[model samples]
Target: MSTPRYALYYAPAADSPLWHFGCATLGYDAFTGEDIAFAAPAGCNADRWPQLTAEPRRYGFHATLKAPFELAHGRSEGQLRAFAHQIAAGLSAVPLAGLAIAALGRFIALTPAGPSPALQTLAFDIVQAFEPFRAPLGAADLARRLASPLTPAQRAYLEAYGYPYVGDDFRFHMTLTGSLPQDDVAGTTAALGQAYAAAVPAAPAVIDRLALFRQDSREGRFRLLDSFMLGR
Candidate 1:
């Protein structure tokens, strides 16, 4: 069946205009301006992480609900798009409440310093609404997880929901730098911080819209295909 594929993304389209500030720091070519190339300063090379502690490995620079999934048998993209539109309408803006960069120890990511009901609601709504389209985790994906030997908690969570990251476990972040060697951490953090400051002048109010990404074939970088605005 040509290895049918689809993705359930965070729909970060509204932020796409400036998301490059976040993506570029992490070495992803944000589909914004002329594709620019950037490098990690010192500690955040990311190649050195022994396990899947890296954003690229787990979740790109995004905060996805389902991390994209192939539609199960007897499903179509048109239906998926319509379903997404419905979900977007029900969601209010994710709130521009201003975020901050935190040391996730090995990595640096943007997170809400204080609690925001808007953020939590959006996450729950996105995950639960589009879940019906999620296909069962395929063998390849499952094998990769088993290869890493899930922890007791991870295994238990997976057994129950097919994904180790969810609900109470979910944290919203826009990954900026990768985990680096202990020695290189300082310079990398400064470089990334400066980069973000230079990127967005001020935060906008109410983030609305969803982005749909499709793989060219297979083994291709996820690219922005279309964007569906919130509600309508």
Candidate 2:
């Protein structure tokens, strides 16, 4: 049996419009651990929708803060939970102008419309503050990460944090689809942009809470474990 892994993420409140839009688009509700049907955008292929979104569906809908990691030898889930609460209590919310649908590499996601120094600092701080709870990456995991082409800095970060995209290498994104074929990128982006506009409300986005997510097994979908409001 595979051991459970945990991650820190920023998921909008369950009742919020952005949360509903993301969960609907992915066809899975991380909070409820249930599947919800989503209509394909007018010009998109409904039949291919599942294939395009299969990967992100597993993770559900959230912007990753601390990438998934197994608990360290001495850490218990209770300790981790208390730590998350402590960390959240001292941090203020990070506000954004809003989110924009954008293509990142081959996948599409909701990205911040503009940069926020506070958001970046928050991400980095969590990565370091939670380091003690993260076990070292296994050999197979390390090999898989190294297989990708990474800059010297990213490789260094992988060695240190077990995730290459932390610190300065991180770009906050709530993934909307799996990597698409080069030929499908343009059309997919257009369809996703339109769908996003229709589904999500017009409001400034804020990172107001930190959610703890758990994956029961290697093949299992992640689900919401708990959420702690910031500055509470």
Q: In model 1, state the lDDT of residue 75.
A: 76
Error of 2 at 114 (Å): 0.5
Task: List model 2 lDDT by residue over 31-70, tens digit each.
Answer: 9999999766668788888888999999989999999999
* Lowest summed lDDT window (length 10), candidate 1: 49-58
- Candidate that would win on TM-score: 2
| Highest-scoring model, lDDT | 2
Model 1 alpha-carbon drift over 4 Å, by segment: 1-5, 11-17, 26-35, 39-61, 146-157, 216-218
| Backbone-clash count (model 2) | 0
Candidate 2 lands at a TM-score of: 0.98
lDDT of 1 by residue, 54-173 (tens): 345233355555555677677778888788777777666666666666667767676765677676667666767766777777788777767765677777656554566656666776
Q: After superposition, how far is residue 80 of candidate 1 from its true place, in Å?
A: 1.3
CA lDDT, every prediction?
0.59, 0.93
Query: How many clashes show up per model?
Result: 6, 0
